[model samples]
Target: MLLELLLASVLGFIIYRFVYGDKEETLPLDDGWWGPGSRPSGREDESIRPFKVETSDEEIKDLHQRIDRIRLTPPLEDSRFHYGFNSNYLKKVLSYWRNEFDWKKQVEILNSYPHFKTKIEGLDIHFIHVKPPQLSSGRTPKPLLMVHGWPGSFFEFYKIIPLLTNPKSHGLSDEHVFEIICPSIPGYSFSEAPSKKGFNSVSTARIFYKLMQRLGFQEFYIQGGDWGALICTNIAQLVPSHVKGLHLNMALVLGNRYTLTLPLGQRVAALLGYTERDIELLFPFKEKVFYSLMRESGYMHIQSTKPDTVGCALNDSPVGLAAYILEKFSTWTNSEFRDLEDGGLERKFSLQDLLTNIMLYWTTGCIVSSQRYYKENMGQGFMNQKHDRMKVYVPTGFAAFPCEIMHMPEKWVRTKYPKLLSYSYMARGGHFAAFEEPELLARDIQKFVGLVEQQ
Candidate 1:
């Protein structure tokens, strides 16, 4: 009897630890100041200021001169993009940028929506706030905060903004209209970079939470991909009550026991709660998950360790900067593009749109600051952060994009987001879903919102 009681007690303890531990807890909302100098004693500025994207003739002249001065080294015969951005294809992109791409017009498009900046945590946080142009009678739009990842700006959502804010105008369902707020992650584009060390995703989440509170939104929906996904997850972890719904195109749920079993073969993976779709996306494990990560993570290793060294060169040369950033656009959009001569860039995006993104980095001189984000987030180690161990209590939704660097199965997502209410396998898209397939992404967001509202 004593032995049986001890055995029962051990099993029950394990069950309780697995099922109840940390489920209802939230991350402590810590304070931070990222400005260069010491924190000011008085309250920081809380006023929002109107902002515009501007460029002078001198800026245009300097860009043209740099393009003209570019020296090309011929790519290996028939190398395609296997090694990197092919110099051969880069010449064509540079030619278009120098001769035809219009910066002033793109700038005008950038300013079409309402752009504003407000001081938060000693930084000028830049964001575009777009309200529904027209709404149905007796209905108000839902407030949604969408964040962009590294090497991407608020511009990624420009095409998707209209679809969400005015679905009826786009011939879609008008049931779920949104008041969209897309903010540049601090140090990415126009948002100011952190001067101090240890400014990680948790700090960003707290700052964005403060921003939403200042905007008079006590509750709002949040969405993101890449780094944005992690930051938004932190937000949900920090303040579960404030976040109505958490949606993501990508999820960082690796390094857990579930993921460790991925290498046990498809039969075991299926037995471990992975769906058929998950098996299909994750199998051929060596190529799809392991080697692919090894191949694509070189830039991450560099940025996480010694970003300033490379940032110096990228900031100094326009052509070099284009080659560095645009390479990710090519391969990340579709890994198979590496086999094509032009990296299949023109298939999904126009040269004008691509260069416009590159120009944001060039003009802002923010490449170094942006690179430092990787170091702060992952420089210490992965899976060691407090938020990583915490499960989010907010209702969550995930869109599993087919070619997103690495595939995240719904089973894995549910581990971190126990309240996951929707998980859709997106029809088509890769890392830059909003920029590449705006209509598809918008519809998915509507679908997720509908489900959340029903609950």
Candidate 2:
């Protein structure tokens, strides 16, 4: 009995030591987590300014007339999709967009939000800034910058903006109130398109750091999903001191092909639940990963190889634009709804809200420029680019969405973001979490910041 008691005490002491002893030390800012890559030292070409957004009454009338024409014309019958085109749905959607979608109203709705444009690293970055209505008697409103990804816009946070900024009114203010700033990544929306060839993720990070500095935010929280995650990660790495914390919906790890192809034994263990703590610590998403990779990665292959060729067609044709964006809306949200025509978008979003995002791209004629994002980042030898580095030190929090096209399990995420603090498996939400599940996302964001702040 005494021996057994001693063994139990020893085991308890060992477990306690393992849990609490010799914790990982947070790195200092001077460690150069941003890496030592040479950033091009250049000035903005004053000659190339942001294009004037045509929001005049006459312009609105002209846009309505063009949409009306597309509606009146009968689309090609015998609707087809995926492999080719869906003429029937095309006609229906165009009719709804032209006759019912109300672009003028959407314009006004967009104007309702406080929008601003600022110059950053030779680009005019556009962002929506909404301040909380009330601040505690002594506290100033905290700034939070939310970024959107490709095939998405700042519109992703339209719903969440109100919830964050005026939480008392929305019954969530007590939970969390954020002075929200949602930016349309350069080349995505009102933001100025990059004038040069080499505007990749890391460059964006540096530019945004300068932006926050200009805005007088010595420190602020950052949040993003999709390519937004890339920018957030970059910001954290580039200037970890200025960035207070980062919350990501799509926490992608910039891993090489080595991590992509794990060994057979580890793979089997992940499936059979026989993987050891050491092995399981490394391999997170072994089960069902193969299925996701095979099913939803057609666009990656196409974009990586031939983006410009595809961008040209999408830019010119309105029908092509709808097809490209809508297809992703369907497949990415949930695989169960993969075969459905609408992709179950209505399950989380209204057709009106969905069309607003599409119309933004269509009207701006920036569809091609947006697709070029892929080309710029995925161009020849991009992975092997001299500036490529995967170390990030920002206080990072990640939400693992079950239905995301690419899943980055916690262990895998730790490889790229060694400072990762909080990891949660989101019960719901897919790629478009901010849009599809704002309440849940807001809760997670609050939790993430709260934990990091406490630390």
Report, for every candidate in turn, its global Cα lDDT versus the true structure.
0.88, 0.67
Model 1 lDDT per residue over 331-413, tens place: 89989999999999998899999999999999999999999999999897655577766788999999998989989888778
- What TM-score, over all chains together, does every model reach? 0.95, 0.79
Best model number under TM-score: 1
Q: For every candidate structure, what is the RMSD over all alpha carbons to the true structure, in angstroms?
A: 5.6, 9.8
Error of 1 at 37 (Å): 0.6
- Any runs in candidate 2 off by more than 4 Å, and if so which? 1-87, 173-176, 254-267, 271-287, 381-389
* lDDT per residue (tens digit) for residues 1-455 in model 2: 22232344345434433553434322222211121234345643323222334456675566557545553233334323333234455666666766687767788788778777776655667877778776778767668989898799988898888777776776663555688877777788887777666667667767666666667788999998888887887777667777888888876553422243343557654664432543533344443454555566677667766767887877766656776787677667875665444445567777688888987887777776677777777665433442233456678889877777765667667655667898887887788998898878887888887788688
User: In lDDT terms, which candidate is top?
Assistant: 1
Cα displacement (angstroms), candidate 2, residue 101, comes to 0.7
**What 10-residue stretch in candidate 2 is worst by lDDT?**
27-36
